[model samples]
Target: MRLSEFSVPDTLAARGALALAEQYQSEAITAHALRSWVWAEAFALVDGITGIDHELLYVAAVLHDIGTVTEFDNHTLSYEHAGGHVAIALAAGAGWESERRERALEVIVRHNWPRVDPAIDAEGYLLEIATGLDISGARPDALPREFVRDVLDAYPRGALAAEFGACVVDQAERKPDTAARRLVDGGVLEKLAANPLEAR
Candidate 1:
């Protein structure tokens, strides 16, 4: 499968999602989100995950962490849930049908899951694994080493480790019941700190 087919979607919602992510998230987070797209697309190409909507993955990648921003943060909701609701609203405004809007929500909400059955939601499963690869460098051999190098060179991780760490830590402090707390208490910081991608 050629990788040329996997790329940022040119749809209205995709553009809006990127714009909103840039407007609301810090630069590190925005780059992290975009890197997640690159990772997801790369994974899809290698794994031959065809026939799905690339636009949905792009939208999910860009806005999956929007709730981490102060503007969208929810005290009672996990960041992914907050981000999913925000994505659903944006999708509706972008003229998506109800099913597509809901699917976008599913992709964003499940991006952090440890596992998502690909038969049910390929985009979610892709995003979950992609974000894992980006954030913690899980399954490093899944993608070509040269491809990973090109992507990191193009996007650069910047201060993602520090920036995202503080954000999640803050989220944990405010919402002890959420996944952020679980990640914090489970030593996700150490994982991020030790992530292979963090190196130049």
Candidate 2:
């Protein structure tokens, strides 16, 4: 959450997404618009995620066009490749530990597409969940039953464990949709193409 821990470029990317989100909120962006903004913001945030080298993951999430941007019907493959490219680029930039960068790339590669490694840790799991959540575009009040179903389907076995799962569910149930919306604005998409993650 803290920007101090991230690299300059990472920080800039996050700030750019934030500005876009704010713009969308003010304009009362529609659900589709908000979904786009959310994906961009989520990508920026994922880029700087702590305890995980998220540069590649962020790129994957940002470019995870589920029939939105690219022509590919299988967004899973698209996201994997996009993330892989980002990882390669970031590695070339020499901003992260080589081993960590490799692992990050691996995580992105396995995120949705079928791979030998299906297991994911907390950060990766969270990224997957967040990615699905953003694409689903489930508003607080309008959370389709299918949204929950899909989340459950994706994470059939609760990694949070029973007690933790209960707590997460409880919190989610109590938290208003508006609160989640406030986390990121609805206008993020339009500005994402232009904004920089950090302020120059």
Best by lDDT: 1
Please, what is the TM-score per model?
0.95, 0.35
Model 1: weakest 10-residue lDDT segment is: 1-10
> Candidate 2 — which residues are off by over 4 angstroms?
1-60, 63-79, 113-119, 137-200
Model 1: per-residue Cα lDDT over 1-200, one tens digit each: 23344667788999999999988888888989988988888787777888768888899999999998889998899999999999999999999999999998899888877789888898998899999987877888887777777778777888999988998899999999888888798788898998998975
Q: Which candidate number maximizes TM-score?
A: 1
Clashing pairs in 2: 12-197, 12-198, 13-197, 13-198, 24-187
* Model 1 misplacement above 4 A: 1-5
- Residue 100 of model 2 has an lDDT of 58
Query: What would the C-alpha RMSD of candidate 1 be, to one decimal place?
Result: 1.6
